[model samples]
Target: MPSSLPSTLLFLSAGIFLAITGTLDAITFLAVIGCAVCSLLTITERTELAYIGGLALISISLILQAVLESKCITCLKADTLILAAVICLTPFQNFKLPAQIMSAVMSVVMFFAVVTVVPVESESTDIKPHGFGQYLEVQETSGEKLTLNTAENPVLLFSPSCSACEKALNKVMEQDADGTKWKLVLSSSKEKDIKKANELLKRIGYTGTLYTYDWHGSVPIVIYTDENDSTIVSHSVDKTIPLL
Candidate 1:
């Protein structure tokens, strides 16, 4: 077997993983194709070109994460794997000065393109003095409405297509949350998203009340309101789950 075969397989695997877990956005889809092309280049002994492609892929991944504030663990894992593939191909790289300069230029262009083209969601700036009550009210007017239990102090904001949300929900299922009345809020109201959310909840055996909201912020958000009237909002699964 060729020594480059492992690197080729690694590149292919990272691409497939991203395709499966990532949203079908233009950037993500193009990245997947880039990975496939890189793998093919590696197999064909064009390691220099493959290495340049790997660098561009890494740049795109990091740029998206920074711009989107995405908390998708699956996307992160795929990026890490792509990095590994790039490292594996490093020893085989032999770029001339002109080629190196061109690669750098290309990366810069891709960076600007992603930043300009991707639509960013604007977050709500209003403070919810009534905590979950405000969320319920907004949902009633714009999205799905649900009755919140007065006793339930924790609310989880998530999106069906979010990898971090799925991980957070899985964590909740694995632990002891028996007495807690948890409220699940979906950030999107699209039919496909709702269908996927319901399927996820059913698979996890979650019996909590699920609501939909027109949320603009990054998700897998956990809101905990203490008895002292203090509201704590957590964005990551690790920070959010411990508070539950």
Candidate 2:
């Protein structure tokens, strides 16, 4: 076989491999390997050197892609691969300019997509009743006060932050069983949150007790008591509570 024939075969194989797999995964990373291997083979004088460089490029690209997806590297592996690939081509004067440009663009877009899909963190808003023993004193809202000293009806423990609490509140209001008095407690950790929950309750015409700024440790819990303040029912404001 002629010297030019081997180089031609190398370029053809690399191109075919890239065409099949490049778009199947990310076009950017795979294309870089394909172009690098093809370029090294077509330009380098020695037959052994061309074959060795192509094999090395494939290995490095595969390893880099693995680390990128796994996030095992310090910086994202995709970014590192792009940087390394550009550096490798810089040493060679005859590189495919268009192929390198496309790979760079694709890598950036993939990174942006990954960032958009990641979940964000939020702070907890459960209000736990603390120091209640001090404020056990009965206070009246809207010139109406229910005695918390006796238990004549079932209590519904609720929190504004809890989806279950909202559903439960709706049920008690719309589907009252024999119009029995159901004590409502809006459990919230912050006074502002409790106040907001109370406003919502009021908008829904809920005449329940609005307990604000009460927390036990880090957890927030709300207690619902009968008109006489006995037979308390408690519910914790947590993520696991299901909506009705």
**Cα-based TM-score, every candidate:** 0.57, 0.29
lDDT of 1: 0.65
Candidate 2 lDDT tens digits, 1-244: 4444444454555555444333223444455565555556545544344433443454465465344322211122333343343334433334446545644554565455334322122453323332332123232334343444213333343445333455556666665423245444433344555565766676677654553322222112333334443333233322222211
Best by TM-score: 1
TM-score between candidate 1 and the true structure: 0.57
Each candidate's lDDT (Cα)? 0.65, 0.41
Off by over 4 Å in 2: 1-147, 176-180, 188-190, 207-244
RMSD of each: 7.6, 19.0
Q: Report the C-alpha lDDT of model 1 over 80-199, residue by residue, as the tens digit.
A: 666667667766656555555655564465445444322233464223342354234325323545565423546677876566677777777565344255667777666666777778
